[model samples]
Target: MIDLHTHVVPPRTPFLERLAGSDPRWARLEPAGETGDVIVAGSNFRTVRRVAWDLVERRERLAADGVTGHLLSAMPELFAPWAPAGDALDYARAFNGWLAAEVTGHDGFFTGLGVVPVQDPVAAAALLGEIAGQGLLGVEIPSAPPGAPLHDPVWADFLGEAERLGLLLFVHAVGGALAATFPHPGAANGVVFPSSIGQAVGGLIAAGTLERFPRLRLLASHGGGSLLTSLPRLDFMRATTPALQELMPQPPAVYAQRLWFDPLLFDATLLMALVDVVGADRVVLGTDYPFMGADPVTHLDDPAVPAALAAAIRVTNPQRLLTSLTAPT
Candidate 1:
């Protein structure tokens, strides 16, 4: 299984200092040691856990879990709106450069998803261009709303540019004000609800962004925040609303086909249900690795998942999503 949702951080002190200074809330945030790294607080949310995992440790963890490769992403707090945009972009550039350096010679063992400063889409676009030649499989953005919604007109050009560049967009639902309503709200409870992110993705689809940029590959973390169950209602609403009907293509399934979902549901039934709804091709393996409630091995061991589906979720689907990083035929 190729775990597509692991996270990494740069060890540079200046970067950490910048992060600490960029957001005022960092002063009140506490740190916890996990996997030999620390995660600090950011903004009003406390559920965002940050850890700096070394490449060696990450590879070892993958090997132990029978995971072939682990795609590196940013922690949720890394893209907070409260952070300085320019500083965030610089940190992203430096971090992506470091990540690319660490992963390039490892073959399929390690691949990275570049982080972008979505708060500043233009800068984000520039950073995307800089990392285009790097062995980055995709780009990670925090889920919309608390940061930037996918349907926000402000991000249209950025999304369009990403589409033109043939890069996949991976949205990990992060810090938000609505996380308190979740079943198990934590210190960073504001960003814990995957359902809210799913609703945001649904809204983006309803707004015609997917239709507008058909070539753009999108991956929503945490089983697309319950996408399997949400699609039916989304389709029903679209059909009943003339404006939505005109904006979206026939049936919502078309949009589903264009998007990909990661396997982080933690339940065999939910994961399999996603497969039944979106098919095997759109489901990719993701273990919110090194984080609480995320286990790499268990996700791959579900009996309800067929071997082929599991393999696709673990490897093939991610390869398709991060097309640029795959070796040539």
Candidate 2:
């Protein structure tokens, strides 16, 4: 099966290290033990496995997880939206180059998604050509940028360009330095991250990103966070609220069907709930890979699910989403 949501990071090369250390706002990676590195952005961020940048280990582990291929993006911690625009652009270019080079020789075994400085809309829009030229699949941007939401007028050019190029934009949810608000330990992962994705998805629909770019291959990570449960409410507000009616060309419920989501909810009932809302065609298998635990016995192995539905999530849907889903070759 093709896993759409795996993460792959590059080594903290001298260039990236210098950029982050020189600025307090940039995200920096600090070596912890021999096994991991600490990601410091707003706070002492989480440490990730050494395998994050180890392509060989990543390939072997993907094999161990029983998948034919992986769609890799840099770990969420590496997306420093708060950093200076030029610095973030530099980091993104470096990462896009490194990732494109790493995924080149594997035939179709590896696919890559690069990062961009979403905080700088004009610069970010300008880089799409360069990113597309790098042979990268698409870009992975954080759900939250600096000031305005993703669906703001400032992003129309970027979104339009992505649509024109047929790029698969994946919006990843990241809990920035504001982890203190979560209060309880691990609340950053359990609450903040996924909830952010849901908010971004709803905002985009309510704000007309999907309406403006109907065919934009926009994807939401982590089972679309809280979106499914909020669909009725979104539809309610969209139809009755005059301000929203002017902004959204289509209602949230209808626009939601046009969006794509990964079933990384880690629960069968939750997965079924997602499928029930968006239908199986919109759901794809995206194991957050290596972080949320690789699915040793994946969802496809469940006997309770019909063979047809399982096939769609595990293979057919991913293949359709990325026509170049050429893997294991």
Candidate 3:
């Protein structure tokens, strides 16, 4: 079985220091046995387990948990949306290279998804080819850049390029202005991140992104962050607002089904709600691995889900998602 929403990080390198120069925004980790504190710009960003970089520990966890493969996204703290294009692109290239090699070294135990500097759409567009060249399936973007909506016109070229490449987009909530508004970790992570992802996913549907780029594929983290409860209001607004309807002629939920989601909701009821909206065909098993344990429901055999549905989420869906190591043809 495959876990689609796992993460890994590259240890700091001197080149990254050279890229940053005097900038204090780059990420650094302080190891603590099986755990570590991720510090960015001199402040503690988040505490993470060693699975963030240790493939050995990860392999053990995967074996113990019965997962066969993992999709390795650069840990969310490594997504530096606020950095300047030159620094950001360079940093992203370095990180992407390390991540791709890590996946290769794991002997088929992991698949890779890299990151791009989204603040500059043009540069981010250029990086997609390099990321594709490294044999990663796709890229992981923050729900949005610091202050801009992802579906804004500035990202059109980038989105078009990604569609042409058939790259999968893993939309995790990490960037938004709310991080500055809520300085405390609990406020920033618990509520703001979820809110950010929900807004970005909804914004993409309402913006007719699918209409413009039909082959674009997306997988959202945290069960797409309250998307379970948000679509009705979105459809209500679309029906009532002529401007929205002009942009998107279909109900928001109809477009939502075309995208993918991870069942990281931590509750069977919530997972079922997401499955009902997007369908089990669109739902994949996601552990948030090494961060939220290997399996949300413990194991597929536990009966939280039916045996048939569990096999589909654990195996069938992930195979379809990773059918092409290159982009989808």
Where's the lowest-lDDT run of ten residues in candidate 2? 320-329
Off by over 4 Å in 3: 13-15, 180-184, 293-304, 324-328
Report the C-alpha displacement of residue 61, candidate 2, in angstroms: 2.7
For 1-329, candidate 3 gives per-residue lDDT tens digits of: 88898887565631475765656777777788988887778887778888787888888887896788899887786777767778888888888888887788778888899888877888889999999889988999988775567888888888898888888989998745667787676667778767778888988887887677777888898778867688999889988999989788888888889888887666776777777888888888787776753446554455567778778988899888888444345
Choose 1 or 2, whichever is better by TM-score. Answer: 2
Candidate lDDT values, in order? 0.70, 0.78, 0.80
Q: Sort by TM-score, best first: what order? A: 3, 2, 1
Question: Candidate 1's C-alpha lDDT?
Answer: 0.70
TM-score of each: 0.84, 0.89, 0.90
Which portions of model 2 show Cα errors greater than 4 Å?
14-20, 24-34, 39-44, 183-185, 293-304, 324-329
Q: Pick the candidate with the highest TM-score.
A: 3
For residues 97-144, write the lDDT of model 1, one tens digit per residue: 877888876776877788777778777877777777786767988776
